[model samples]
Target: MKPVVQLLYFGYHQAMSCIFPVAIFGTLALTRIWEVPFLHRYDAILLILLAVQYLMYSSGLETWDEIKVICLFHVIGLALELYKVHMGSWSYPEPGVSKLFGVPLYSGFMYASVASFMCQVWRRLRMDMTGWPGGMASFALGGAIYFNFFTHHFIPDFRWWLTALVFVVFRKTWIIYRVRATTYRMPLSVAFVIVGFFIWAAENIATFLGAWTYPDQREAWRMVGVSKISSWFLLVIISVIIVAQLKHVKAARRAEPG
Candidate 1:
């Protein structure tokens, strides 16, 4: 009973740590049923999401630093969204007052939400990393991976090469996270795969909620392919590296369970 309670306590806080993402995705799911007086769905989504973000900051769920990181992700995500939408990888089908370059403004929040989650998780779990490949290597790898997301359309995709690079760079790295009173460790590469798998699951939910549609899902809603997990896995690495720089990522100590 004590162990069960401990696990539940950790789970609850873990969920709470994702309040920003929960709010964003939850709003995305809810707006399907919500009726607005004059606002288009996309516009409404942007407004409500912005409001929720501010609320999280004001309510102290997110610190100013976390908000800053989240904003950075918004820009990065938005840039990628613009490129992807332009390339016809996927699209925003609904008409939106806030649309620019065929990408809805709220679309960036999807990326911001990932940043928010990472920031909150880092703070809440007291995360650290060991054997990191150093800032320069990590940043260089991240840049190449991000570039591939765009250049793949016109050039040969180097994702497999980048994926191999990740292993070469991070093979010795491990993430240490505190859960409840216990500290646990996982290989950085394994963590990427796990987080990426979950992100793929979230993408499926997002598409089903009409947040956006892939080229394949426009006619009929279908499961996002399992293969996309590789893409998401690579994306999570980018997010992790960004947050690690901001959070002073380092090796974890042997913290005893309380």
Candidate 2:
């Protein structure tokens, strides 16, 4: 393929495979603006997301294993949502029968969608990591990041410290991804920051569409704070760790003697 075509070809597949979850978000956002037939916004979002998952599986766009990982993300995300919403970090302003403790069940799909994107891209790009830190350290870093999201509300935030630690740990790490016949590599930390910005952008889109709202956004829509990029950066780290352990282990296995 020509260089341009090669890039487009790879992008096309990546977009198609990842589009299902994004479609759910888009559909919900559109529905919030327009009328939808009987269901409430939260209910409609949940139904549409579940339907999309089924379609992706039945159409072979996603595998059962990937679905399992997405589901795990759903649960993990919901736990955090429950706590955060209760803490008034943000809220689902819309009323719905499917809500639990002020959190709409479909809200979990937001996090699951990120996992879906990661899984889709990992497979599509044939991603591998090199010079990775030990599994225990990765887990510790990821765990601290996840906990800091909650504990920081009451305690001193450790995010800057953790961010520095992430640099130290992943300093030598590189992500290898294949595009058509070509393979490319980039620092894994760079990939995390890039993906983090994208996710932050998506969060702004979601909030603007009335999917949910932070305290300040309830009255009027605004660009999500740039400071949020740091949060998403940490989240991408957690999400990457989960998917790497679940899906990207093949790269390490390939290096072992048969």
Q: Score each candidate by Cα lDDT.
A: 0.89, 0.86
Candidate 1 Cα misplacement greater than 4 A, ranges: 249-258
Per-residue lDDT of candidate 1, residues 105-199 (tens digit) = 99999999888888888888888888988889999999999999999999999999999989999999999988777888999999899889998
> What total of clashing residue pairs does each candidate reach?
0, 0
Cα RMSD to the true fold for all candidates: 4.1, 2.0
Candidate 1 steric clashes: 0
Residue 226 in candidate 2, Cα distance off native in Å:
0.3
After TM-score superposition, the amount by which residue 134's alpha carbon in candidate 1 deviates from its true location, in angstroms, is 0.7
Error of 2 at 22 (Å): 2.0
1-258 per-residue lDDT for model 2 (tens digits): 388888897888778756866786688777888876887888888888888889888999889988998898899899999989989999998878899999989888888888889889988888888887867888889999999989988999998999888899899999998988888899999998998998898888888888889999978899999989999899889988888876546556777896
TM-score of each: 0.93, 0.94
CA lDDT, candidate 1, residue 98: 99
